[model samples]
Target: MVKNLYMLPEGLPEPVEDGACDHLQGLALPSVTRPATSGGSVDLSELPGTAVVFFYPMTGKPEQPPMRGWNKIPGARGCTTQCCGFRDRYPEFQALGVSVYGVSAQPLADQKEAVERLRLPYPLLNDTDLKLAEALELPLFDYDGHRYIKRITLLVEGGVIRQVYYPVFPPHLNPTDVLAQLRS
Candidate 1:
């Protein structure tokens, strides 16, 4: 049976807030250029106006099984669902004058595949080098010899982080939560 990549399994562990992102609020984005699925690269710090950047560990492909004990990790699952949620709500974000970007440590090729497969309107920034993660001190975890960023969302305005959403539970609802904050 093919696992549904867009659905989260029942009883998935919820991540607890660890204050990892507390220092991010009101922080200026660093000048780091990351390759994007849309081609070339984007410097989040140079972007004008409002933007939302959601960081997830990694997205699983249809053909491949997820890493061992993937779902057991508190916040490791649901990347695909999270991305799809953002994709489905892209129009709303655009209408609100906010740009959306997803970042992961995945390579650009993998990100491109996900963009084409998921029909994502916004680009997924490649953070394979962890440049942005290092600069911001984003939460990270190691699994199967690979390092992954924890799920977190940032509301950026004028190159500054205005809001930080850590421990985003039920990843699919994250977009809704962000929209609510943006609307308020």
Candidate 2:
């Protein structure tokens, strides 16, 4: 069964600062369209206004445990909690005229499971080939023979990236922080 790692006594580790990705500011969103857990293609370029795209490493499955040495990787845990945080604040984000999406290098099947299990309102984009990570030069980590994306959030407006939140820690608290930023 898929255990709720978030509730486990040994949950995700605190993220280490990787510095802000100011260099990515003003960069145009990638034109590539990817399959989403919600059963549609997510075309970043097609999103006209504000979009909050949070890149997470991977979501664990109830039937499958995380890869070996999962806890040893910094910012590698808490994908579920992070997704749930966005889910809880989804309506608030919408009220602010913003759209939220979770992106990861995980397969479509894995993402779908997370969405279904967590009842996530937003779609989770699948970048199994690491295309988005490559285009944005997002950090990558390899564990248990699988490549994963690091945790980060991007604020995109009018198809252009406006701001980036790097080294997100305490994953469940990010939505509030992002909401505050958007409001400010």
Candidate 3:
């Protein structure tokens, strides 16, 4: 049911292929500029070439009501795996002229902490409001006593979604899966 809702219409939409993820996905992400830890909500519509945006969950605190318990998500494992997978194989994507980026609801402080802790070479965007995730209309889990972004990956080209992955086991996101898709 969810997958069907997210399926592309045969191929990329003309307007999106014109350099936007707007038609392929929806207007949500295209209109919202998520404040990156580096400062700014990058316009996904103008993204050049192929790129990957990974979304995760966060539990913000008062001062930074957007800075608490982000790593608490189960999706973090899958996220980390996918992130490192990309990092390890980053050169491959670059060689192929693809850009790679990661997004999460964690605050910049927390994101920086994780990046430093993991020693990742790439920058991670902070999407604590879950706005980015919501903009994409991605499945979100909230019940019992937890809230987290379902592990998801988007293969975007010229700002349009070439492919999307959901129900991805964050802790064990098969890099090969992404590799094969990206290679395709």
Candidate 4:
């Protein structure tokens, strides 16, 4: 498929400056809803308590640098590791009284398939249209000259981003962060 205009015709405009989500800690993310894995829609926003949003690069395609994602490198160890980490520690997150969801620019089909492939118990938000990405002003890159999502995490509550995590390297590395958000 051809790239969209959002790309400087092929890539997003370089980020002017990183936002609060980059350095924020202890910020409470709000609940959000996207099309459900079962198809149609589900609204997590109505769920109670604080919410954590996991921002993952598209989990489809092989680790192809041409796809663009973490390290701006194709096929970088991105989604699987971090997500599995979350999966393993999901109970802990649950006890914290916070809901968690995964977000990506990939289409709904991809997100749904990923939920099944990973057997994720939570919902995945499809930001494929990129409205959410644009609002966040994410520092997108062209890997092997192709655009893809950045690897980051957001902690939000009540429609506000309380904390953001970048370079969530070493997947599944969940430290019991009492902070509002733990990206890594």
Top TM-score model: 1
Better of 1 and 4 by lDDT: 1
RMSD, one per candidate, in order: 0.8, 2.1, 11.0, 8.1
lDDT of 3 by residue, 34-146 (tens): 55544565766678877877664532222333223333434433345566676777777777777767777656787776666555666677666777677676666663355
Model 1 residue 67 lDDT score: 65
> Candidate 2 residues 15-94, lDDT tens each?
77665465787899878888988787888878988999999998887678656777777787788888888998999998
Candidate 1 lDDT by residue in tens digits, 5-61:
989999999999898899999999999999999989999999999999999999899
Worst 10 residues of 4 by lDDT: 3-12
Instruction: Output candidate 1 Cα RMSD.
Output: 0.8
RMSD of 4: 8.1
lDDT, candidates in the order shown: 0.95, 0.84, 0.57, 0.57
| Prediction 2 global C-alpha lDDT | 0.84
> What clash pairs does model 1 have?
none
Q: All candidates' TM-scores?
A: 0.98, 0.91, 0.67, 0.66
